[model samples]
Target: MSALAKQTITEQEFQGFAVTDFPASKRLKVVTLDEATIRAFNDAVSEWTVQGIEYKPFLRFEVADRLDAITNYTLGKFLNATVRDRATGAFLLNYQGSPNVEEGDARTEFEVKLSTAVSHIIGLSNHDAMYGQYYARFTVRNVDDSDSYLRKAHRRMELHNDGTYVNERTDYVLMQKLKEENMQGGDSLMLHLDDWAELDKFYKHPLAKKDIVWGAPKSKNVESKVEHPVFFEEDADGKPLMLYIDQFAEPSNKAEGKYLYEMGESLEADANFLSVPMPVGSMMVMHNHFWLHGRDKFVPHPDLCRELLRQRGHFTE
Candidate 1:
């Protein structure tokens, strides 16, 4: 458990939303938008289609402003504060009740817009090479042929930071569950760097600062390789900030290989990580450097299907 107390939020300070600590961890905040807020947000941005916002980047900020306006501009301020603080750099955003919208793709569009709004309020998402857009939407099924474990349903995707193979600074990650069916397990896994007991051991090691090659699989759609150390940088308070992934790190020599391998193992074995189950229409946003995110494996079912939307980018100072 974190030393920080669960943040207390009252309706008096805002409208149509509530904040609480996630039951499993104090490091994450659970933000619930009341139906009234959702209705207002839907009505406010009803004029703009998802494609229009995608095509016109400024409109995305408009969408975010409309939602933040519902709470008298407190939602955006709260969200930004939560994600930037190292002690509480993550949030699970979900509505208290059903959103005022029709079922099917219409609702999916609302979800996408909602995520876009949330993401833009904090920072703009990087161009997702995998999806050829600012955000990536993909599905996982019982059987698949993919170059990475991203779409595989049976095995756990070990906990690691994203943007390890890319040159861009992925300061944050936003993942929303657009839809799912016949799904069991597959909760998101998250770990704060400060919570890992072995963090100091690795961060203080000599190899931690050495440049290591990182690359992506064929499905990632990136042909080039990048170089960076596992602990590539530091936070404001000098805490270690990581950029690493077990599968993508191409260590150059025996020392580099073992260092990377052992770091992955140590991260996987940590006990402080949180397993968060995101309901449909819910999103999880985290500071990419301090928080490592992954997915748990799904149970086998012939008709299992899960669709997810992902946005990763750096903070705009």
Candidate 2:
């Protein structure tokens, strides 16, 4: 059990947010901020535009502090505690009512700023190689000629962790839906390591700790191949920490190949995985090692377009 499992707090502690279990998964905490709280946050940070926040990194923390201050600092403490707890290291944060922002570019810019503030409250986001920025915003259109499975709309992206091929410490991953049009059947998929039925079968395997080569495709813009074990390390309690991705891993031999192949198959077939539907302006944040995330296939349409914002980074003490 995680430390959070034993910790208790009164309901009155959180002023304008309601905490509840997600429909399909009890482990995930759904935090919905009230309209008043959202308005207060937006109003407090209205002066710091996205450009200003980007230019001054310290200002990002100020933005986070302002948002947290609205809840008397209870929201930040609760969020950090929930994310650090192994038993429940994930949360879906969405406001009860929409902010007073215009549609189109203006709304998208506000979404980016809001996500940035939330991320800074927990930790600093790593520079995204794909976008050359602290956060990445990309769209999934009806036609995609991308090299990897990321932008492909017709097939599932597969269960995997982020920062597999990169050297950065990706402690957490935040994915927010910005816009969607003519979309269906593209729910986010998540599988907790502890909930995976076959975790022990693979974790105890010989190749679990063996170094495997990983390389990204052209679109990723990462030229070199990095090496790491599937079970990269253990947590403070000595539990396994996984870092595996099906697409980028380059198994050198038949044994390694077989091991990875079986692991992927096991993950896909696991019944404990959660299929989460993210509405516009909602974001899902999870511990990178303990949680494996993916995307379901999208319904085909000539004008299908879904814009998403992503940030992967390490936690700050």
Which candidate has the top score in TM-score?
A: 2
lDDT digits (tens) for residues 1-317 of candidate 1: 12232243223375678899999888899999999899888889999998898899889888988888999888887888789888899999999766778999899989998999899889989999999889999999999999899999999999988998887899999999999999999999999999999988999999999999999998999999999888888877777889989989887799998888888899999999899999999999999998998999999999999999999998874
- Tell me the lDDT of candidate 2: 0.90
Candidate 2, backbone clash total? 0
Q: What is each predicted model's overall lDDT from 0 to 1?
A: 0.90, 0.90
Could you give candidate 2's per-residue lDDT for residues 177-213 as a string of tens digits? 9999999989999999999999999999999999999
Query: Mind sharing the TM-score for model 1?
Result: 0.95
For model 1 the local lDDT of residue 1 reads 18
After the best TM-score superposition of candidate 1, give how far the Cα of residue 80 lies from its true spot, in angstroms: 0.6
RMSD for each of the candidates:
2.8, 1.6
TM per prediction: 0.95, 0.96
Query: Which parts of model 2 are misplaced by more than 4 Å?
Result: 1-12
Each model's total of backbone clashes: 0, 0
